[model samples]
Target chain A: MNEQEAAALFGALSNDDRLRVIRALVRAGPDGLAAGEIAEAIGASPSRASFHLSTLSEAGFVHAERQARSLRYRVDFDRIGALMRFLLEECCAGHPDLRSCCGS
Target chain B: MNEQEAAALFGALSNDDRLRVIRALVRAGPDGLAAGEIAEAIGASPSRASFHLSTLSEAGFVHAERQARSLRYRVDFDRIGALMRFLLEECCAGHPDLRSCCGS
Candidate 1:
């Protein structure tokens, strides 16, 4: 993941509402949840949920799939891991003595 | 780190200038860089660098210490690691089949 990608991902997760949406989808498991279910779980209006989902999907933090008549959203775990690695690389590079920073 | 902390950290990193400041500080090592150096490295004005540094410091993403007449800023690696863990925990909880998502 490059700095630009990490920056975009962070921007996507910055809002409270969006963070809640991501959490809701995450708790919904790999099968994911429909748009309405995500709205219900996050107590967001359908329009707001749709907006957040679109932002997340655009940032590559989450993926959306057509499921019957509804859309299912799930966290993109691989992309997220790459983001984690990008940040950890900086940490270790900045502090060699703290090379164990990401070991745990 | 909880959702709130993670959210605040992400919010701090959402800006392009702030992200550049972080990259500069990371490359500067633990001793960090003075505010002017950060501004120069990122091509930000003094006031702008100060604003970004204050936001990052407030969010606990960076730490600042007085160095003579200047202040040195360094990334808080532990806080960053905790934020990564919080996000990873959600991924694993959301998808048991992806337990290795964070292993790499």
Candidate 2:
């Protein structure tokens, strides 16, 4: 990704609530979690959770799918992987010290 | 690291100029770069580069060392590795999809 895209992604992740939402969804895995479940997981009010989830969705960090009535949100592993690759390869320039962290 | 610390680090990276500064430093390697050199590399004015550099330094993404008259800045590989580990293990919960990005 380019600098602007990467910065935007990081901007989406710059909030504590969003980071908590991401971790909660990652724990929920591919089956994902409903909004209420995610709210409970993050100890956030439904409205707060929804706001963060929307930001993550907009940033392509989370995917939302309609599950009958409620929308289920899942972490986007491929997008996150792309972000890691950008940091490790593009930002870090594939430096050995940083690469070792990825077990590369 | 916890959510707050991770968020703070991401916040430091949530700007194009800072990201550019980081990539340039990565390219420069451990020898690092002086404020003037970094400003030139990123096409930012000295004052603007200094502002972003200060933010980065405060966030522990980069280290600044006094070298005679100029302060040389370098990316902190260990801290960055810790961040990657946090994302992979804590945030992503060691999920296979995310782990594969790290080649682990």
The models' CA-based lDDT, in order, is 0.75, 0.88
Task: Point out the worst 10-residue segment of candidate 1 chain B by lDDT.
Answer: B90-99
Model 1 Cα lDDT, one tens digit per residue, A1-104? 66676788888888777777777777776798998999898888999999989998998888888989999888787776666656666424535333344443
lDDT string, candidate 2, B1-104, tens digits: 89899889888988999999999998898799999999999998999999999999999989999999999999898888887788787888888988786565
What tens digits encode model 2's per-residue C-alpha lDDT throughout A1-104?
99999999988988988888888888777799999999998899999999999999999999999999899999998888888888888888888988886666
Q: Which stretches of candidate 2 lie over 4 Å from their true place?
A: none
TM-score of chain A of each: 0.85, 0.93
Candidate 1 Cα outliers beyond 4 Å, as residue runs: A90-103, B90-104
Q: What TM-score does chain B get in every candidate? A: 0.85, 0.93
Across B4-102, the per-residue lDDT of candidate 1 in tens digits comes to 667777888878788788778778876999999999998989999999999989988789889999998888777766666666664245343333544
Q: In order, what fnat does every candidate score?
A: 0.45, 0.80
The residue pairs found clashing in candidate 1 are none
